[model samples]
Target chain A: MIDYRGLQALAMVIEHGGFERAARHLFITQSAVSQRVKHLEALIGQPVLMRTTPPKATAMGQRLHSHWQQVRLLEAGLGIASTPNQLTVRLTVNADSLATWLPEALVLPDHPNVSFDLLVEDQAVGLRRMRQGEVMACLCASAEPVNGGRVAFLGYLRYRAVASPEFIANYGLKDLSRLPDAPCLVFNRDDPLQHEFLATVVGGTPQRIHYCPSSEGFVEATRVGLGYGMIPELQFRDLLASGELVDVVPGYALSTPLYWHYWQTESDVMLNLRTQVIKIAKQRLLAEA
Target chain B: MIDYRGLQALAMVIEHGGFERAARHLFITQSAVSQRVKHLEALIGQPVLMRTTPPKATAMGQRLHSHWQQVRLLEAGLGIASTPNQLTVRLTVNADSLATWLPEALVLPDHPNVSFDLLVEDQAVGLRRMRQGEVMACLCASAEPVNGGRVAFLGYLRYRAVASPEFIANYGLKDLSRLPDAPCLVFNRDDPLQHEFLATVVGGTPQRIHYCPSSEGFVEATRVGLGYGMIPELQFRDLLASGELVDVVPGYALSTPLYWHYWQTESDVMLNLRTQVIKIAKQRLLAEA
Candidate 1:
């Protein structure tokens, strides 16, 4: 069996790009770094580093390092010595969602016993991590439920084709076809949801777009007439109500289904969470679904 | 604001039974239950119960009950005394991911000040709660990237269309299109990713699907020839390698893009998680744009 400490030392070496630097980072001797890497390679029966000017982690090293990191996080959560009923609940979520509804869900005072650990990520990655056991729950796009879990369909979150009136006045998008060529604001290149919707309408990905990675920035960009992008219905609703945002596509918007999925494994805490979420979805989101 | 005691009383009533039963559950008189309910109703500006036979909760009462449940779960995590580090992290994640990758990200021994509380849930719902601030992080769907944070585009998770040899021989799905309407094992009705992929290839959604809500059951079902479903590449790779399973769609499996998102707010803990996740993603996941 490989010693975890040896593997950890080697990882630090690779991260620092050299044994000498790694020694400084870990407050150990440079020779120790070299020794650990050598020991790890001997145990794995594979070379874990390249003996180059700036040392690089071999494929084996990278894989092991990745695995080691996961072990570390798990240990941290478990390390919390429980005092009586002090159980920690770790959650993964997206930032915008954190800013919006999570606060509403965690109305304290009533829940005196529970404390939280928040892991924020985008919807896509959050699900992947959740599946990996990095987090306990997530709000994700795949309406398809997870196995060993109950599916609480939170319904589709609508996206309005929004733009500031000033922008609309400048570039009158008379039809959906014109959107591809228009200067559009996008969350990022990876955000193909808007493109997917546009493809459904225009038959292909849009050619003209600018990347705004910030959620607030994306909305603000649209408001300032950077271009028309699909803004979440909830955020745009008030803006639309205030006449700040005009729907480029009136009476039509793209919506992606959202689902709340959780493990079916019976834990009083987890069971309660699932039930509460389902109830809330039934009240707030099921109608939309 | 409403008194938490009233909510607690309502919870007891709901959990126990009618006012009389609730009184027994709380070890209080029936009249107290009646009074507490009335007080709660007045506080929320809505009636919570019928006050009649069997005493059903009203619509607003249901909402309150759900809220109370979330509080209970959060309270469970917190225990009694409030900790100085109340910026708790809560997560809902799948077990496989937790088993394989998540722990490595959260528990780096070096980061001592940072702590986590974990809740395991299905990937989909984790995101929903994250959006609601019920959790700070989640593993979810949607590669489009969220704002107020950076998106670390972790590579796509590939799922192979595998089946046990027995299943392939019995169903003869060499050409997936030729297979008769065999019951395709699925996590739940909401899980349409695989179905959507099939729809794209088969030209429509299949009419017959066997739902397996348990992850283990889903995997076992596919292995035992109950049906074929797309299984995660990591878990099923060995099965395919050993020739225990056959790939229905060789070289045609689906790969879902994953991303890591978190608050850009100057939070040491969130930043640590974000950095760790990105590093791991680059190494383990298919690191692409």
Candidate 2:
């Protein structure tokens, strides 16, 4: 059996990103922390931590982290109250959901003892993080599950093409010919949504664009007349209802289908989170078309 | 002499992430787009794009993009009415500044023709993006100039350790003994400020942490009792003043010194931006000690 002491030392080292800091956390000497990890490596005949500036976990080290995380989850499931409600659920979620309805799921009492380690990533990028063995669950665009993980269709996170009233007036965006000259907003360089949406409706991309990486800031930028792009349903629903946001295409909305990918475990925390997130997603997002 | 058509085709393909979409924007066939990029590669004796699934710019491609961007900026600076007031200024900024005083810079009338391409990255990583030939000016923490790029001190972006009322009450965080049990919040995996701040103030990291990457969402998560985190001055100043956020460590604030690194150019647009941003930074951020 793997030593819990060494596993913990490895966990602290990787999580905190160094041995000295991990030593402080584990209430052990820096050399002791190193020795514990080294001993584990000797036993396994594989290096766990790479000796980078801030030491990084190797693939073996990542698996070890994943294993330790699962052990913690199982401990929580079995009511092993050694630490009295101190279990961090590491989850990676897309920014849009966090800005919208995921907060409801977080506050729900199903996992009262559990806190969270919410890593906000874009959907296209989040799956690799899961594969890296860092997170317990990922709210991702990928329908395929991670190594032995399970995936459930949450629903299509509906987005509508929107711009502020001033933006529309400034560019005369009602005319498709003028659309090429108008400043557009995209989340980042990787976001194909704006260009793809434009390609479908207007036959091209905007000649000029502003890439605002923040979800809330995207809305604020749009409101203040920086540019226009796809805004999520709940985020724009109130704005569109109050006429704060005008439709770019007038009748077009895009729905990005999402999936909840989680570890295939009977651990109560994982199961509870899986159920709660799916339930909230169903309520918040549009039904899959 | 290099061809503008081929350069534009390369830019469109990289920006939009595909050849087909790029062709749609350029009003050329997909084959024409591919051929233009190929011809440029043949001229340079190096591949511009990696031809990956979503084709990525190689090092040569990125430098070409950078040269193209500087040319665009220079064109605007020269009042060359070639594109009729259309230039996108690509910049990577730390999110806190964006949340606070950077928007003021955006609205200012320094570069009337320039739109923005703002990529939000943490200070630790923004430097690499600037080096990757993605951005012309980078608002970063790096004091070092990038490949003869001009660097100026923009003063310190101050952050204070803060938590909502209920979190302090729940964790009894006033006592340093109870601090380890407190659930803290950090921006993301690469963010060391929270733990580093805690280590200095209380001599250890919090046992648990939540990673909220969004500048706006960080404040919202803290407000909604997700977890306590270090918040920026303009973001948490009102909350702390109103007693909505309580200081985790009273009388202590962490100031992160920031620098603006811009492309070395005599272009009026570049010069104007440097002046405006520096002026705004001095007004908004804390003076370096």
lDDT tens digits by residue: candidate 1, A1-289: 6678688787667544578966865678989878887887888889988888667777677676645644543444443453222233456644334323333343222223343444445566767656655445666667665555555666665676788787666655775566666666555434656776677767755444554444544565576555678877655677888998998768767766666666554345555655665554455342552
TM-score of each model, paired residue for residue: 0.37, 0.85
Query: For all the predictions, what are the DockQ values?
Result: 0.01, 0.44
lDDT of 2 by residue, A1-289 (tens): 9978889889888777799988987788999999999899998799999999689889988888878887888988777558463566788888888767776576534555676777777765678878776788898778888887889998888788888888788778878777767777788776778878888887876777777877877887777677788988787777888888888887787888888888776588888877888887888788864
Per-residue CA lDDT of candidate 1, range B176-265, in tens? 675435546555534666676677667654434554444434455566555678776665666777887787766767776765544444
User: How does chain A of every candidate compare to the true chain A by TM-score?
Assistant: 0.64, 0.89
What does candidate 2 score on TM? 0.85
Candidate 1 lands at a TM-score of 0.37
Write out the backbone clash pairs for model 2.
none
